[model samples]
Target: MNKNSKNLLRFAGIFGLIGAILGAHMAGSGSYAFRAVHAHILVVGWLTLFGWAVFYKIFQTTETVLTKLHVWSAIIGSIGLTVGMWLYMVKPFNLPEGVTLFIYIGGGVALLLSFLLFFLLTLFIKEKK
Candidate 1:
């Protein structure tokens, strides 16, 4: 597998880990709010972004630096938000509520940039010669 494919697989595994933990917690707590956010971060933020990166590589598509930055930023940011969710929603932490919100929102913005790049990349492609 290429670098991008590997990234996708890695992120998938991360998501799986998060999901397993979420499921285990849900069985006891019966509160799914955390589960829902975790699911979105992993499945949507990580998995979806990774999938796009891999697809782009498999198709031998070119990307600019900004696109690459977006991909990495999104992946890293998602991980951050995933942790935030665990700390704040899943289990209370020492972090203040405001700090938690900032982390989550920042991560979300990073994810938004990733998707924007995905959409922009899709629009500009080399016409098959």
Candidate 2:
């Protein structure tokens, strides 16, 4: 009903889409070569973001710069991680191996930073008297 809820639902839809693709891939290929990527998409993209959104909604936290940063970081981190891992798994983009590794590492760091920001936000939550 609120912005946080909307964001969570939107990301839930994203997870659903990724899950569908994963299911189809498994059905057709019978190989989980991209399993890590799929997992990241679900966990980081769907679960983490949804969890934070729920937290924000329930706590009635006002929108802050950190919240916006969290949203963007989560989005970018998820996409970067997913795409980077996919490229790492399969050279679909024809990028150099080192470049793919860099992307994967960078994505991981970005995701970590987002989590840290979330933690910071939690610490700053106003307590109900």
Highest TM-score among the candidates is held by which one? 2
lDDT of 1 by residue, 9-121 (tens): 67767776767777788788987767667677667755685676566555555546855775686677776666666666755767887788777777777777777876776
Candidate 2 residue-wise lDDT, 1-129, digit = tens? 668667766876787688679868977999877677777787877788788767766675677888878767776777777788889887887999999988887887787888888888888787433
Flag regions of model 1 displaced more than 4 Å. Answer: 28-33, 126-129
Clashing pairs in 2: none
Question: Scored by Cα lDDT, where does model 1 land?
Answer: 0.67
RMSD of 1: 3.0
Relative to the true structure, how large is the alpha-carbon lDDT of every model? 0.67, 0.78
For residue 57, what is the lDDT in candidate 2? 66
Which candidate's lDDT is highest? Answer: 2
Could you tell me every candidate's TM-score relative to the true structure?
A: 0.75, 0.85
